[model samples]
Target: MPSPTLTRVRQAYARIEAVDRPEVWIGLRPQAEAEQEARAIDARVAAGEHLPLAGKLFAAKGNIDVAGLPTTAACPAYAYTPWEDAPVVARLRTAGALALGTTNLDQFATGLVGTRSPHGAVRNALDPTRISGGSSSGSAVAVALGIVDFALGTDTAGSGRVPAAFNGIVGLKPTRGLVPTTGVVPACASLDCVTVFARTLPEAEQALAFMASPSGRELPALPQRAPGPWRIAVPPRAQLGELDEGWAEAYEAAVERLAAAGAEIRHLDLTPFTDAAAMLYEGAFVAERYTAVGSFIDKLIAEGDTGLDPTVAGIITRARDIPAHQLYADQDRLAALRTRALTQLGDADALLLPTAPGHPTLAEVAADPLGANARLGRFTNSTNLFDLAAVAVPAGLTPAGLPFGVMLIGPAFTDERLARLARLLQPRLRLAVVGAHLSGQPLNPQLLSLGAEWERTTATAPVYRLHALSTAPPKPGLVHVGEGGAAVETEVWRLSAEGLGQLLAALPRPMVLGQVELADGTHAPGFLCEPDALPGTTDITAYGGWRAYLNH
Candidate 1:
């Protein structure tokens, strides 16, 4: 019998077939192949093996190899069949993620707008008339449309993030070299980083963790940030550039929301980051794209195959005219600017910015392809250039109902930290419960009544001391004593503001909801007792958790 996961995978494939947008995919795996993979995962699960992504479906940008699919990079002339999957894709497969197919992208992954592909521009999943930001257009669309659980995209100059913003999804651009690039087509070999698109921050993080390179050459351990008052840097108003009226309003509103959520918003001059962004295409970095495929382009042109997109071909051709000294000069300038950028980020946990200046329509991009595309990169291009990790998340919708999004960027190896911060911006709040409210406990019904969903089983940071308060029900109170505390087992539950309010209203004295530090240093609203009450309570800290103490 087919498992429920396999059944869902089949339904997803059916939905893909039913959709009208053909250009969203360049190559789709046969239904039989996908089904087989799903069944294999189900069998593994039945046998008691744990798979982080068991039965989850995913798509890869055509630029990345997936064994049976041709790696086209959105240019048919450049397509080649690979005998093995890209290292990242192989890792996902090993984690039990099934491949749906290879999705479309900008030709040679050269354009930020999706229209540059000869296969046809990928339409926005929500509104077909608008442009799906690219060159990761199709991958983002696949996730947005619910055709896949997550998808792999490549980011050199914001290809991964822009698309996610436009599609109202989470885009996680890991630090460069955190995930292996082997077996993937390169637009800019040195600067490129594989990225993930998913519906939630945790989902994207999970995918990234599995795909991240273990060699640790440039893949330092992902960083964690303690949750509390987060210091976030924003660009000065004058440097925000021109934005669509809806987007402009949305950005300001987003900043206000973050401030309300206890974030310290600091306005700063963004010239250093902006200058580095200019260096990507306006300076010597364009030459790197040329170096990657210049000879192949030259060969195609010599054979009179004018099938390549004119803009892509023109961009590569111009690189040949750039003096070698100009490349070195740009490198030197970039190195100095990087230092300034780092200095500007001092004391700031992350830099929060609009994902893109505006959402343009298909007609607008068709009118001035290059200019419109360049504008989309205003906030994104500087990221990979500065070796930053970023997560683009949906903020809300524009006045016209188009999706508006923002990005959280941090220094290298801070990918997980950025995701943790991004979670706070989401509508739901994650609360860590250590005592009676844990799953299967008496108070668990309170969570279920408020529409709360259990998220995961975890442990508190060793800095927490757990005490059993003297009450009729005997609840546990977690206190952050800074040091000499014990790690306690806990459960995380997600709930809405109204639900949280209900929970707060029902709370008894001495046991109030406050920030509790997790083992990873991230904070969540959890059960904490007043310092005065801690002295009279029995120290159940040695018991590790409420359940353990109750059993004893």
Candidate 2:
């Protein structure tokens, strides 16, 4: 479970205290603002006023204006004091959520890697060595750290999703315009979307529903049933380059799972998608960002903003060269390309792909700024670029213990269908525990690495025996039998098939991967005992669960 909430918001404030690193935030809310909001939430709960978000706290990306704070987008010179919150922020506020602060991002939301900000490189919370994907860096990290329950970020070419993937959280990029951007700093205004990041799919979706306008905007309906024997496409095999082998294997397993769940999978040409991505900078859409942040960057440079990161300047500089004539041609080509690409995906419920090719370190991003950031945008850049909606939910971890995720992309207004599919797939999160493997364990570096969430589960049924294998790395195995059985305590991990595949392959001899039946009669893949490896092993099932054995 996440850290327990505080009736006094100030108690919860402890999580926000400075960590060893600082890049996730550009600035924070005033002490008075935080205190007042916390008090207000407490009062509502005491008075039984029915707070929608209850104790939820959130942070907005730097570019979105929030009341009582500066909207800097990481450039101090470009700061502005807004009198009111952005429409989305206002929506969250009305829903009873407290605003924590403003988070760090690539200056003017120009880069995908978190290192492009002057505040500090947003390091991965799980492994301080890796980059916390961006430009929604701070928001995603904030949630990952449990300092906030949910956060608001922006997505244009993967800004929101990348950070979520990096931080091992759920990043929900709503359909274009699904959430208002009235007070936001636009990356590609026409393509920008205010996205959500949370620990689970339901939390993100709950915040999204609460984000609806008071006027009660109608949501798109979920497809009534399975996409009717749909023909879904995976990315072309040749372009799966630079991907971590774990992600590729995990993704393939996900494909198989989907096929089993009644969706047809196929491979389709990715030329159109790549062609569109090339147009983002190579074409005129660069001007849209300039139109949004260009004026500010120009003023900051003139007024002497020493805080603007160099790479941000370089990225903004490219926007200056996009000619007006080229924009029309690019738009025309984009329209045609989108039609072809959508047709390719039209026969399917949604497209599937790895959220990122691979995770990288902040140092790697710093060494080669543009290329590394671009590589992180592999599956994500095309979503908002083409005005499609995407929801990235946890698939689980690869054998290497790295988090792997898959995103479902669909046409505009299909947020409901996308969300339904995401929920239907939510049960895939069964997680098993040994030692600190339980929720809130300190040794869960791998859990944080793959963003494996803690789950509710029961022990394997009475047919299994638990044995602590004296293996070097330390692991346990479950054996099945009709006699001499004990109900061994175990955790059922809800994993993405992609994460399961790599984990399965890494099983050492004497320990085989197989299914274990749970107390509830549900089965999740787990470590089964190889008859050969049981020698010298102690049957500790009497302890009930591995946690009990470890505690003793």
Candidate 3:
């Protein structure tokens, strides 16, 4: 094994062992087997081949098949060993993501409460006393605990989202059918979409790309420059239902942050969307759950097996008898609701909502599994119902010390937009350039070499002055002057954390990276000059920017 990859693998295993949360995984790949996979990846890396997910470790939800691990779906009675990996798993593995294990889940992917699993309730990584949100419970906890780089889960009705909210991570539930579902156990098959959980939006997006089918519809490309502030729709406070203590304020704070970052928030009537969400289980759509695993569970019950969670079994059993006529009638109602919901969402880039009503305790979930789980899905269940894409990001912690989150819901194929909006709501390492490092300038190549991408062209908040520093290649210094300052022209660039380190390492003495407040109320690391170097610098504030000064 290449030393780093092997070392990382060992550390991951060590973390998993240290956690001692057996419920987080239903089965783990033998340490030796994982080591062998890492060694093979090292050999490929040594051969100069690029692997996007190189040396990355990830866990697959048990409902999804991973070769050598029995596809248990958290129901031992229904367990079966699959000879091949599921399509999603295969794609991720091909991208060099080593599988560490198959995680636990609500039996047959049924509950939004992680406690339905016979393996045991998946505990929240942030607080063991809290419920981890389910049926993708273990998957989210695994990512949140940093036991793996990322994880794969399935979302039929908020399974992918709620867990992320409880655990405080990014959960990207792609547009339906974007990631192939072959070789995976069905939950509500048609609406069952695969999801990825990572500590950040970018990592989740990267893993999604590796797993997305080539033949699937391509995500819409983002504009080279932002046209204007994003139009984000939010439900009225009254329609948000009863929020937990501090959750309402946390959500408003998240919205305010987005607004400060230049998003135009529009009040929206959520009747259509919320009504459709009710239909997922409350309406005839529940029949689909029965269609997925009813027969298997029925056979198990007939054979006198009691492996499935009683609540899960009761749900599927009742769903089997939902009249076909009711299914058709509800389907028609959903069609109309989808249209109305989309209309209400028209022209808006995305709909922002809390990922869950609140973080529930294990006792709360156990006390009222149905009520608690239903409340958790209040905002998320409608996503797939509307055929929309969503990105759940951590908003902040509630005053009560529990993590809170919000999700951006966008139209189908708008995955990129949703992710971009999600990033805006989170912290980012963006750099502002006023001079040679601006696009097409002499020193711009340094940024490109560090894998930076241009974010947008804007100006510093009218509180900065530009100066032509006496440096080779003629870099400009952006001085933060509180009074009589001009809105200096600049471009923002987004780069990786490692790229930032490299930039700091090679930074010239006179130029230092410091926080620059932008016109849009956001701040970024920007090029500034030391006071000593400003003595002989030419005052160029009147010229607006370095290029303009040079052109004159």
lDDT of each: 0.86, 0.75, 0.87
After TM-score superposition, the amount by which residue 262's alpha carbon in candidate 2 deviates from its true location, in angstroms, is: 2.5
* Cα shift from native, residue 495, model 3 (Å): 12
Worst 10 residues of 2 by lDDT: 1-10
Q: In candidate 1, what are the lDDT values of residues 1-552, reduced to their tens digit?
A: 679568768878788878867899999988887788788889898899988788678999999999989998988898899999999999999988888899999988897888888889898989899999999999999999878889999998899999998998889998888899999888999889889998877678889989998894455565455556888998877798888987777888888888998889987779998888877889978998888888888889999996788888888888877888998999899999989998888878899999999888999999998899889898899898888989999887899878888999999887777887787676667999998899888889999987899899899989888888877776887788876988999999998644675576467768778888887888889878888887767888998899999999
Those runs of model 2 whose alpha carbons end farther than 4 Å from true positions after fitting are 1-8, 30-33, 214-231, 424-552
Q: Which residue ranges in model 3 land beyond 4 Å of their true spot?
A: 217-227, 427-552
* Distance from true location, Cα of 110 in model 1, Å: 0.9
Models, CA RMSD each: 13.7, 10.0, 10.2
Model 2, 116-212: lDDT tens digits are 8778888887888888888888898888887777899988888888777767778899877668878998788888888999887767888998765
TM-score of each: 0.78, 0.77, 0.78
TM-score of 3: 0.78
| Alpha-carbon shift of residue 341 in model 2 (angstroms) | 0.3
Please identify which of the two predictions, 1 or 2, would achieve the higher lDDT against the true structure.
1
